[model samples]
Target chain A: MSASYSTHSQEKTQSSVFRTSVCKEALVMDDELVLRQAFASDPRKGCELLFRRYYTNLCNHAIRFVYSKEVAEDIVAELFANFWYSRVFDDISTSYRAYLYRAVRNRAYNYLAWQFKRTDSMDAIEDMPVDPTLKPDEVLQYSELHQKIEHAIQQLPAQCQRAFLLKRIEGKKYTEIAEEMQIGTKAVEALVSRALTRLRAELKNDWFLGLSGLVILSIL
Target chain B: MTPLPKDILFDFFDGKATPLQRKLIEDWLMIPANEELYYQYLDEWETRHMQFFPPLDEALTQYRQELNGERTRRVRALYDPPESPFRFQRWFWWSIAASIILLATGGGLIYQDQWRYSTYRTGFSETATHRLPDGSTVTLNANSVLQVPRFGFGEGRRLVRLTGEAVFKVAHLPDHQRFVVDMGRGVQIEVLGTEFVAYARNRGQHVFLHKGSIKLDLPQGKQLYMKPGNLFTVDADGHGKLTETAPAQSYLAWQDHWFYFDNTSLSEVVQQIDEVFGVQVVISESGLARRRIAGNFKATKADQLLQSLSELLNVKITRTNDHIELRTLTL
Candidate 1:
């Protein structure tokens, strides 16, 4: 980073954390470097700094899997708490962003799997992994795709967006979604179907998931 | 099938891929282009995730507390401090004495800031009226505080920070400088020049424009162009609704110590009494509390209002300690 970057992050945390780095320039170091240094010296400060850096992004990523804010928060909180409790500093082979993002994604999937296990057979999602590979380029691509999908969803009508979210993200059935949204079952289905068709069309050029993948994705 | 079709990536994500398909997909992900495509498929499946936005501030606050809690427990365990109640008592009194000295010195330093804004407060049954340097008049209600800029009144932005309730009759500047009221809690009222009755307390902030138009700056970056009879109410949760036509004069009745309630619930009237008199009032009867009362009364004391309400509603008002209780009158 540039010379101004350290002063910038310092300004961000100035009101909260007391600057402890005797050398002023060291405080402006890269996030991963600071995390490693802090973890080697003081684990608590390292954890807090890491939380500040990635908490929002991780929560946003978790919210993608489990629609509820409170549930997503619980997943992220557990991920962080587990990281500290298990002392995963020695295991951080990749970048901190990759490690944290993968952690949040795994925990979110576990939550979804548990939700599905309650209603259906656990065998449907038996091979869910806890530590998926999160390469830097893959993370960037997914983030961009996430933004594009978010924009497409935003283009939907207000009620349609609500109904579609209730069905897909919250995993509500047609009848349950109808009752919650005060719409008929047919209307709920139509809205969700419209959202799916619109999303497929919007992502057609960018999607590498050819015709068959799109069909399968829409089905299950 | 060497590179594995992209369909296998979806099957892999869904946990339905066969062993051979999974191996092919894993091998494909080793290449950067295939990995990007794989992540794009994953993002497509999560399109609904953008609907709800979870604020990270509250989560981080909770996390900070947990971190501090763990650190405190670890420190206590490592130190094994002595459990001496007497020693704690001695240190507590010494700390109290030190705090008193610090506060005495701090008060003097605060009074020396003549250039900064100063707060004007009113106690119970006491109202304050002040004229600003820009010829604007402010009438602060009882148990309220208004902080106005001391030195820079007419220069830049004519700004005043308010809490509780106040009525402002702002003066119009030749230069057309805007006057703004920053009612903490993310609520701000801005105007070029206008007269308005504003109430901002525990419940929420309400603005009733008396005359002239003003632009209200809402918390969430929404601006409201309010007319003369507009009544804008924003609750603590930032949920706002504006009533286009309002009894704007009735809102300013408190300036003269006269309250006018037209079909307003007794519970709401009692809340106003609590705010005006700064007292604890308990209504025992639920029906009586919900009863819509319409009348006008002039009273500055809680006892006077209670006496008027007792005759008007045919209820018995009794004082028990500092609390006033209202119950149905027995025949």
Candidate 2:
């Protein structure tokens, strides 16, 4: 681990427990050294700094899962609040970015569970693991893949992107999604179909799902 | 497996399908092509992230800028025992602004400076000075935040978003670019080649032009021009009314520790005090919300203003742990 890496692991909080970090400066600050010292002394300060660093990115990431800004912002805030109060953050022993990204994933799943409470479509998504091997290479690869998908989706018109994101990523029931988005269920179906057709036209046979894609998405 | 009706497919996906419908969709799931497309959709979706971030943030940011001109000058005017609140305000907004500016101006061609700006905020009873990208000057008061986006007229719109209140002496740019200040209450003030003082919050937008011409655009799509010596108040409803002002110099009298209120409501007066002096002033009764206050007091401290108010209105002022109360004083 680099000298600058800090995270919310449960091991460090045996003393302080989970308290929100007070440090909320930017991540790309020129005075990184000053901030690191500050974070080491005050983990809540570290959380604040981390929040400042990732607020926008996490919001953007949540939009990948939910359609409502209110819901997305709430989900992001909930993740931060949990991260702050959770003993794990008090013990940050790794890169703050990785710890937070994983935390967001957990929070997102929880949010998804609440979002899909009445529906049976998203029953397959189990609890997320710590994934001890969320290596830099994998993170980099996924980041790049995310950028590529963003670019591809950006190429499509706005409505198609909305439908595709809602149906696929959110795993939302059509009626619920239609109600949230203020569109008819038939329109939602047509949109999903249209988005799939457009995506298929674009991908051709490029193998969007590498084995896990097929199995997981099939069940999802 | 054969094609199922859209309703049957919907019910199956929603898990509300009857046993037959469930069995049929499950059987259809056995097909490789059909299943492949489903995951492919997820994979592609997980990519673009149309799921998390939405367009509303950008829209709101735009609207926030258009309402209150992007800087709030808060005045948390207390000079007693120093506390953490003062230090927190001084550090948080300044540090955040400095950090974001670094990220924004860093050597990235992908940066849309328009989407980026510095947000400056001050806390109660505190004041600080800041410089803008355009060499303009600003003095932030307590509990105020001003956002200066990444892109000015250099690339596109020269707009700044405001949350609380601030005093601005906008530097003139020769390119004839209009520097616009956006407030939160559905008002925007466009000015150029002159200096002005502005105050705005979530629901109120007020402007006192120092020397140049400013075009005020209300959230309700009404625009008014405030010439020199003009003061305008744009309410929450985006209705703006112009009033004659003594002079631009009078607006700066508060810097000398004095404020003059001419028939302003008790609520409005209390809000100004809370923002400027950083004290929570509460009206004991709801009727005080509508009580019209007209008075002038010393320009030195908050206690002086309180004394003047108590004497004139015969209003008893009580201090509690959380806030000060103003009530009808017993004669």
Candidate 3:
């Protein structure tokens, strides 16, 4: 594995070097260096630069999960507001880009859990042993949870799947979906509810296991 | 463990990482500084495949407002402590009592107008006839609201606000008071003992006089007088037109659940249905929307109208809840 990894790394370094020289525009200075220096000298200017750079990217990332443009923008705005109010930049050890993406992902997950009324899952998330020193484990858990939820969505009935996607992925109102499908709003609501019930049933065991793991970790 | 290459991180982001590669990346991510490199690569990948670009100016403006609001709140918290440890208990109780009284009076003053007016509403597929205090009668169409003042309705002025369609029969007073119907958007009807049908909606403003004379106060300081049987229409763009030979009585046919269409386009017919029944009509083809039909149809419900329309036009109409779809018949 180590031998393969080294060969892969060597090949990638040569290709990246070639690609950067050919396709990429010449950047005068590294963004991180400028941002860090600005932050050390003047915090407000640093915040402005950070927001101008990452606000759109963060919103785009958030909308992939939340599906509503307004909600995505709200989440990014709130994250920035909290970042400023809590003085997180002063103590953050990771690059701002890394911290912002992870924070936005966590926040988007929390929002989805709350929106779906998954109280048990939400409790499991809150109780997840958030040892910042072992952040890789939490990242793995998030990826697994996201994959499970997506898989369960794909397994829904055709009609139920359409209704769920319209409501969640397209950010459409029930009345709008009813109008499009030529069905009543009540039918749309029923379809969405049926989808949620199936999703909850599929996720129940995973959440239980996660909660138990948290319990054991707490004991240890 | 050795650091993973950028290409492997990119592969992981694209969901193309094998278990062995994933294991190596996981081990590499265990280092604190490598996590930053992971995010930097992720950011680069995201930039290459960005799905949306949010409105920057609007978001920045909102963020500035949030920052200012937070600063003000923090300043307030620092300067104004709700209760000081050195303050007397009696003064605290007195201040609380004083604030309650002040809040009550202040709230009452702000909401006093809500108590002065009474609003009447009709739900979807429903119509209602209301008799006002001055012996005037109003028949409201479906999905409409009318607001009339509770007090002083007939004393100094008889004024009412209308949102949707309604037929008004103003009662003549011996003192010669004018009746005014405010249709919003600076359009109003002034009458003295008259019968008229007024249609006010987001689409247009239309007034058809049936009995006696009435004056229309339109937008842009324009006034027009209407004789009986005259139909005055102001479109969504505030362009006004008058038809002297209009069949004014046909406008009141809705009171009898009858619709009179004289070579009316399907689109206009659908708009009328939307106003009167709150049902949305979706025409599958633009050519179908321009088809004209001339007839008197009796339909108390939206489905009945849709059925009759489908038969008359030789088209297919399907209804579900509050939505109706019209399509050309396919053989």
Candidate 4:
């Protein structure tokens, strides 16, 4: 599904460039200039334009790390709200898009850390083994984390891997996955739970410790 | 080194960049402007390969409501006086009528006593700073009243009656005169020269010493000496406890329009908003009222605080007239 979407996106990008037939960098610069001018003249209009321009992109970018649609949207919405209320645009030297993306990335990292701490405390209560040295913000490398997650998913048992992928990636319900696998819903839940535990164990030794745990927890 | 082309950066984003190209891009990202460019490109890439498109119209509508609420609050703050004019006028007429009746009934002593002491008051959502006759400064929090005797205020002893919260900075005199703040319920704070916060409300009485030392005279004839960071609190039933490790600065944050809460429950927070800002908040769900939050929030107006609370808790807060309701978002 993602492969076909990416192909279609490539075609759309090429067509957009051909239709404009101008330097994309110049267009981006012009947009920034206009946005700055709007902010200088009337901040409300600037806020509207800014929100419209980056809300979707910021949420999409944030979902890469947080792995939850609601959380990603919240992260972006909070960024926009704070930007407007705090008047951050007045002193911002960087483009609004850049500042927003960077801010959202940092917020997403912080959210992950908070989640890890909450689950870590719960794990302590349950006497589960937890890695203490793992710090998401310190060790977060986007591409590397993605590769590590993919690698860990591949190492799961075949049925467990299928159940996990169908649940986490495709966002299918337990009942749907059970029907697809010709199993009961309870069996599907057990398979997914086992997959999460094994993935956490598999990724713990590689310094991607609490983050992968949080990623799987977010699915739940 | 020459800047990496846009295609190479895109390839890096797509996890297809060579090791050397990735290394070069990482180095280039060290520059701040280059970092901005990096995000701009990332924004473009995500736009082209969009995974999810949020409901922009709904978000815009929410944003507009927040903005409108803030603007109306600012406008109201600028134009609205602390108390309604008609209420003040009605109170003035009733006092005049009562004073005439007292004179007619030959009850002049009580009226004379009212004239002997001057009172300082802060209306709802308002704080006031006043310099007393003794050159000491007192900053009264919202909805507080302090009474100082007009005649011979700082002669042999200094004493004042307080209701609600205030911070006092007592000026030292060469004559070694002591200042006493008489909070009702037999709780009095005595100090030679010190800075402390006294909170006397329907709930209880509390005194936090910021500098110097003070003596708290509690009920049952018990007395406690408070150091710079000591917090003496008495409940409504006059049960007193002293905390030595209280964060003194957070207690003073309210003077600067900031509220500091440490794992405070939502119900208690709502009660504080009622006291400090005079805003009525109703949490729809009983379970939600027990949720605890810890943070420092800055809000000069009621709506700003409400907005921050809603955002922090991911709750939906709606205001109708003077009443505010909080509920969990049903998404």
Spell out the clash pairs found in candidate 4.
Answer: none
Error of 2 at B282 (Å): 3.1
Distance from true location, Cα of B283 in model 2, Å: 3.3
- Provide backbone clash counts, one per model: 1, 57, 0, 0
lDDT per residue as tens, model 2, A1-220: 3344444222232222112221221221223334445466675565566566566666666554343454455456556555544545545543445455655544543443332222222233343434544433233223333344445667877887887676655545567667988998778767766765565444333232231232211101
| lDDT (Cα, 0-100) at B280 in candidate 4 | 93
lDDT of each: 0.63, 0.54, 0.69, 0.68
Query: Candidate 4's residue-wise lDDT over B1-331, tens digit each?
Result: 4565999878877777888877778776654345545667888888887877778899787677556543211111111111110112222333355456445655335444343345677877888888775678999999887876543355345778899999999998766678889999999999989899999998888999999999888778888898999998888787888999799767888898888999999998998888888889999799899999999998878788888989999999877887999999889
Prediction 3 global C-alpha lDDT: 0.69
Lowest summed lDDT window (length 10), candidate 4 chain A: A125-134
Clash pairs for candidate 3: none
Better by TM-score, candidate 4 or 1: 4
Compose the digit string of candidate 2's lDDT tens values, residues B111-199.
22222344676766566678765667777655777766421112222567676667787887655556778776667888776777787
Is candidate 2 or 4 superior in DockQ?
Answer: 4
User: lDDT tens string, model 1, B2-41?
Assistant: 5456566655544556777655665665653344344445
2 against 4, candidate with superior lDDT = 4
For residue A8, model 2's alpha carbon misses the true position, in angstroms, by: 44
Q: What value does the TM-score of chain B take for model 3?
A: 0.65
